[model samples]
Target: MNKSTTIWGHLSAAPHRSLFLAGSFQALLTILWWSIELAGRAGLVAPPLLSGITPTWVHGFLMVYTFFPFFILGFLFTTFPNWMNGEKIRPNRYMAVCLLMVCGVILFYAGLFAGKLLISAGLLLMLTGWANAIAALFHVLLTAPAGDKRHAWVAGTAFVAGWLGLCAYALWVLTDNTDMLNFSRQAGIWFFMLPILLTVSHRMIPFFSSRVLENYVVIRPFGLLWLMVGCAVAHGILHLLDLQGYAWWADLLLAGCALYLSYVWQFFRSFHVRLLAVLHISFAWLGIAMLSFGLQGMLFWLNGGEHYWLGLAPLHMLVVGYFASMVLGMASRVTLGHGGFPLKLDHLTWLLFIAFQVVIVLRVIPDILPFAASMAPKFYLAAGGVWLSCFLLWVIKYAPIYWRARVDGKAG
Candidate 1:
């Protein structure tokens, strides 16, 4: 092999130590949160630490900003080298940023549990960590030698913006500024949530679906999707400005987007793969989320309507159904493929996937039924149990693969 080929191979073959560390932290956090919830249910604490804004906010923020970013960095490190035709990009800075973020997460959570001084200190640390991570990512993106890699650039930028927004929001919360907090949340979602989801969904959905449907055609143009995103951002801004009277118009824009994305679905159905089917199914939830939010906005226009819990429904659906499902599916695929295992999933894996879907259903369906709110926590617990089990199974099944180099002596 030529030197270039050898370098590419080495870059690809490098151990994903960071990815594993981050994944482990994510899994541990998930398990810990659930355990706290379960304890609350058993009436152990006065009011469980898991019951309030601090826990929920910290959990959500860390999951998005802390846990997943590591995986993102690891993935980019592995894939970008190959994408750039074997150019090496050392990840020492990225790893350092990750470590800083982890420390920030711990400090932030501790402050929430402690009091105001801790909260202030934690926020400062978090901001510093996030800024470093974002800077490191930007440097990597600029130096990576890939031309017009729009998706990578978009995802990376969204992540940075999202974390920055989070930092601002944290400060607002510290100051007891409700308006700023609300605005920050809306800004953060647009800056972070939609972009990251679109980037990942676009890359993975078609690719994974194509695995089952040999003839699957993955559509590439996302101009229309970006337009929808613009509308969503506008809606967020209007709501923040208390001009939510115009929110209905924004919803109309999303409704139109739902229609367009539906066509994308029809195109996918033409290929017909079960693996692909799951992706389409998740996207369907996204479309449904858009429509639901639109409908809620319309209701608000019709009357002095309240912000319904139903909004949580679609958000959870996107997070758990679309984002989590995609992550689980891709991680499973990559772990198996890189481990020199067969592409085919075994019975256990299939069952785990099904269980994940069941969890989504249980978590989502209750929103349509208010009386069922009492039972929602139970379903969440059950879902959490199943999710934890799946991850454990994954660790058991793929630990060897992750630990040992590829059996074929080929680079990952």
Candidate 2:
């Protein structure tokens, strides 16, 4: 281990701590959003904090644009330096950009709640933040050195597209227009889900699994690029045509891909510990969510046999299971790496991982069972509580490391 004085000095100098603090603040916001929703359902509040906005839209926006971006920022900041051949990106500029983004999200949400001109102001802030982030990402791609720049390029492109789509979405929401909203949502989904997740899984999943099982072969799907492009086109067309039933087919294809990937993953490796296990577990949910979407589509084709709630199941699964799990896992990994700690996670970390999984079960499983809908709010509350607790645990366990910096004199 490095000397304590050296570590402390490095930690004080590093920007990783600042980024982590921003991320933690975003996590707290997420928990607060969920808690407020729960309170509304429980009749503790007269009017729901999120009354006017559609719950699906609200949740999607928060998960995709709000909470996820902070992690993305942290990841980019921490990883880009190494990718850039050990040159550190300017920290002060990055911090300023982050502050703008965080403040933008706050204003956007406040406007969403207030239903006033603040929405436009929030959108402006968001656009400014996005421009800064994109510029930073571009700088990394052009200047930073990486063995596999393809993944970074893909992620960057997707992020840009997602941000643009979000701008369109804001306009639509502000104007009470559905056409723009539909277009923006589809574009955003393609950018947020397809390229980003695909790149992430490609980069991390196989490597993570290989740690548990020796000599594991990661199977890459043939023509995956073509398939992804096709899906994006199909999704856009379906939205344009207002062909609701076609979503099932789209989902089915996606699910099939995920299932094939999962099989390949499992064949290659099995992890005994929660840290590694969580990655696979989260990917499993991605597959399951797709399957649920397909199932919902099939039921819709049966002519009014399916309940509206059927669709909500897959949405929740994607949001709570796949996205949340991945974020938590990535955040945990980053926290350890940036802090100059060993990669091995402790029991508390494992418990937190398990709690995240439990939140998925509690949130999604009940939607399928009608009788369970009555109990859904209770489960949601419980799950949200667990999620909040986990974040709190994260803050308690990791804050010092984030604040103090790496133990080694090396930069994150």
Candidate 3:
């Protein structure tokens, strides 16, 4: 019996399909909700404030927790088996994760209009789903036959850290402890998402580039990878300890390593293929973001820790510029390759990606230009609008492929 005939059947047909499909919907929903909130803040309209919750805290929580894990777990679930040549993850396993997470997100939205109790309850559900995801991936890691498990191990360890971070968030919701919330944000980004994203990019980018360009030398420095990961953790720890001014060396060193990789990757050489080009471009943002962080920290230190420069621009570059763009590019490449379509970035998708770059710029502008500080809310609203537009357009272009039968007559 072919399961591809029905919508539900097609969704569960593959690990990536169900997870990515749900993630795509989430990608739209999270940003749309945030954008509306931003509009209200900018005096565009009046939306009801969250109950017993600071909007910024909730915003950080939603972005950190509800959003990227869908794509991250989906990518890991789809790739882990092949990476280890191990047992395949069962449908029920991923479906359980998807259903729990989706329901949890819905409850979270309901909680926004309700109270802290609902919000805390919603996070508990999400935490459970997240734990299930980590366990499922760990099982794959643990059961794999004797082989190279560096990537799997690193990623799996990061998932555990992420799970703990989610727990912190839940605890924060319950106790109103800002320290827990802060730890959650730092752990979620630096310890968890950063490591996983870099690991994936490190593993995949050079391979993809090597295939397309003749005589391309793959330059993956594992030592550098370890160093960058260390610096990332150190930066987070410094912030946790309120020693941010001392993190200049780590941030700068990381910036150097990342920028060196970009130069070696040969950005201009891959533009002939838009798909490969996007990945390269996305990877380049890491260097740029870190450079911003390094310079900001350096400037802060030089001025006796008096004035902070660039404000949130560096962080935005990391979040949207590198993380979001990398997810978009990699997800698109995977979708096309797996769905039996030509592995090319079409003009519409390409334009949407370009527009996303504009979003990053808009987001960073208010922080950089001193005069624009007063208009930060308006700029943020515009940035949110552009960001939503990008995802909305791109999701519309690709979401159907998740559930549709592959056009190449291949099973998922």
TM-score of each: 0.80, 0.86, 0.97
Query: After superposition on all CA atoms, what RMSD does each candidate show versus the true structure?
Result: 5.2, 4.0, 1.5
Question: What does candidate 2's lDDT look like per residue over 1-412, in tens digits?
Answer: 5677654454445455555666776777777786777678689776455426675576667667767777776676566555545446576666766678768777767876786467667767777877787787778778765465766777778788878778877887778788877767777666565567666776777877776666677665537644754665575567667786676787788788887878888832455655677778787887898788778877886666445547477877876788777777877887787677887778988888877778777777577787887787787788788788888887788777765646765665
lDDT pick, better of 1 and 2 = 2
Candidate 1, residues 173-263, lDDT tens digits: the string is: 5776766567566756656766666666666665666556655566656786676666767877787778876676766676576566647
- Per residue, candidate 3 scores C-alpha lDDT tens digits across 263-332 of 8888889898899988888888999999999999999989999987998899989988898899899999
The most accurate candidate by TM-score is 3
Best by lDDT: 3
Displacement of the residue 115 alpha carbon in candidate 2, Å: 5.6
What value of lDDT does candidate 2 attain over all alpha carbons? Answer: 0.71
Q: What order do candidates take by TM-score, descending?
A: 3, 2, 1
Relative to the unseen true structure, what is the C-alpha lDDT of residue 279 in candidate 1, on a scale of 0 to 100? 52
Q: How many residue pairs clash in each candidate?
A: 0, 2, 0
